[model samples]
Target: MQGNSEVLVIDDHMKRKQQVELLLQFIGEPCKLVSSANIGEVLTEQVAWRAVVVGQVDIGSPFELVSQLAGQYKAQPFLLIGELGDCVADLPNVIGSVLEPFSHSQMTQMLHRCQDYHLKAPSKTKPTSQHQEILFRSLIGRSGGIQQVRQLIEQVAVTEANVLVLGDSGTGKEVVARNIHYMSARRSGPFVPVNCGAIPPDLLESELFGHEKGAFTGAISARKGRFEMAQGGTLFLDEIGDMPLNMQVKLLRVLQERCFERVGGSTSIDADVRIVAATHRNLEGMIDKGDFREDLFYRLNVFPIEMPSLSERREDVPLLMQELIERLASDHKVTIRLTERALDSLMEHTWPGNVRELANLVERLVILFPNGLIDVNDLPSKYRHVDAPEYDHEYDESLLEQDMLNDVFQNDVYEPPESSMSTQLPPEGLNLKEMMTELEIDMINQALETTDWVVSRAADLLGMRRTTLVEKMRKYSLSKDSA
Candidate 1:
């Protein structure tokens, strides 16, 4: 087989080669099958093949041919046709094994697996400076907090140390991980991101590590897992705090030994990949609560980077809004502009969801105003009170305190008190309970204003649960219109 044949079958026995060819035809996939008697002859030819099927008898050694082909063409997947006892199923690039005298269904399934592997293979092309620039531009911000994150990324991108990104949800943890991968030496390799919380616990093992054919029910054919796909690349374990305790132990072993066996296979394959895990959950707290393994925590926290929330870097809001608007316009063709007052209102509000919330609001505005200008009046009601001053019941007392301190310092008209409580009180004593209530109300109002009356987000800002925040709002009789 030479040139552009999609499938190559190598078997020294003419009858076996013919049977393989007929099986390929029976599958009804439009692939040209090239039969070869010698591995040497096939290796000498120049061809781009989707997959290769090699018989054990043709190569004398059980796995030598498969290993050689895997080393030569790392992108190409191999299906070994041999007896169950002599199968070479442990190789990194070997997709599966079809036993001798295999049924037609087995041959069809193996061929399909090979095609899936070929399609999912990462591109080998090197990224250009322009591509890197685009990725950098996606992280738009000029505030000190964001600049520090950028500097931290620059400092750590060239190293092989495992990274642990800590931040609240919607703070762009995955974006940071991708930036590190693209800026590192493994830029050309695959960057596979897996959400640990999204997958079911039962299937997560097979999802991370390959499983042998018939290893479990519904596992029709052997498959190369994420680790194999991410070889020489990076594996981003997003929401890793949600990983089960059992899986955490297995993950720790892989990190320590740099090798892992497939779900049902005995051979251990080297994990030639960097690990970058991120989570919005508080892992340290989880460890203290006995939900997370402390040893695993230390292993992943070797090089930690914290992402700043939107409220922490409010100065970058305008720049972020501009970049987000441009991106939306270019990507979705839904352009819109915010008036200065509208921008000011957005900047004043606290962003509990951070950049993600801003992005969502921008998209919503784009859809509502489409290629138009959004003024302050266009804003939702929750954000309309940004210009209003907070109600402070202690304002008079604060002014009195400032005046008394000024009198003492500038006019030298005040005498020192004999004791801490010796100074005479005002005509009326302070109502401590009323003052406390006022302070609580002010804080709740601020949280509501910042989050645009999103109770869940406001609760996050106040370090409380959504239900508790709702209860407090009811006690204070607070409403979006009132705030």
Candidate 2:
């Protein structure tokens, strides 16, 4: 209860100030109460404050002021006393709020929450140069969704709890995992990433847990698996839902026991690495279908973070595009500029593949139009129109029939053309399958052409998954060069 501990209050209204003082006394805490009518005056004082409470009359923009102060004092808790709707309580640093004319219980509750938050908050420390760079590069957006994700990462990075990143493919789940690792106490350790979906089901076990020499026919030498390589660090399991059911059980056991034995090796190894799993697939759905283990799901779902889709954070598209373009220019030495209209077109499109789709488009544009300016018309046809589908049909059968009857009655004409519906087929007969295949190929080729062979975008235009499009391309043996 107190020596140097103090609560800073900012309220121009005398009555509100007295009420806050009364609440502090009622709480029976011996902390000093510092009152200020001006925010500038309170900020100038070099005092270590435990908490800050700002009322409506203290500043024109109470939420903005609180946000600024919260950033300055990361360990200090902030409370806004104003109209409920006027305060933005969603901010990460804001512990709670006390509405005007608050009751004794409400005021006491808010004070307790603030004090608790201040005690639990992490101490502010300057990040190293490497950490700063990693943090900046890993997350690159000012959108609310991205900001919230950043806040969540900051809150959970210090803990050793498992994190499950949920998002559509290309939403930067791995990036988030990396940020968490670098920001955590394990920053000096290795950060290994494994794509569970890309690895073969048979080989995945050995890849994760390692296989001793002579474990299988082709086991030439002993090799450390991802888990071993990620000791004292973080192991990012990308596309964890794609992991086999048997592997899930093994993984669950490893997680529960925190130890694992290599294939064909009886000696168990300590699993010291942190687990950060990511997936585009719905693991819950897989669990319901008995494809994924329920126990394993609960194990990885301890601290779940859902990444917002590109469509959900479209406002960040322009910034993301610029960052991608700059990165491309630096890495590939290719420069490309998008006109205002072209930028607008990109922002308007529904990015199904998220940031990965956007980055691919930027790279493709740079390659196609090196050191050139791209306009709205230069964008893919899908970007130019709201409806990207190639086929559209509108039928009015009644009008067509009426027109036919009118022609018969008014003109007394009853002539049917040689190519009428009944006699449209040629004497040699049409190869329906071949014709349809050709049409399909042509449309696919067109989609590919427009998207510059970016499979995900092309699939979006063709109304299919990227994998489905790839399969069709393989079926047709179509490549960008061939197209």
Q: Specify the poorest-scoring 10-residue window by lDDT in model 2.
A: 404-413
Check candidate 1 and list the clashing pairs: 350-450
* lDDT value, residue 302 of candidate 2: 95
Q: How does model 1 fare in lDDT?
A: 0.70
Pick out the ten consecutive residues of candidate 1 with the lowest summed lDDT.
125-134
In candidate 2, what are the lDDT values of residues 22-124, reduced to their tens digit?
A: 5554332233334444556555324445557877564466666777777776655677886534345566657787864444335545655554464444444
Model 1, stretches more than 4 Å misplaced?
1-138, 387-483
The true-versus-predicted C-alpha distance at residue 105 of model 2, in Å, is 51
Off by over 4 Å in 2: 1-138, 385-483
lDDT of 1 by residue, 46-69 (tens): 444656787745435647767777
Candidate 2, lDDT over the whole model? 0.71
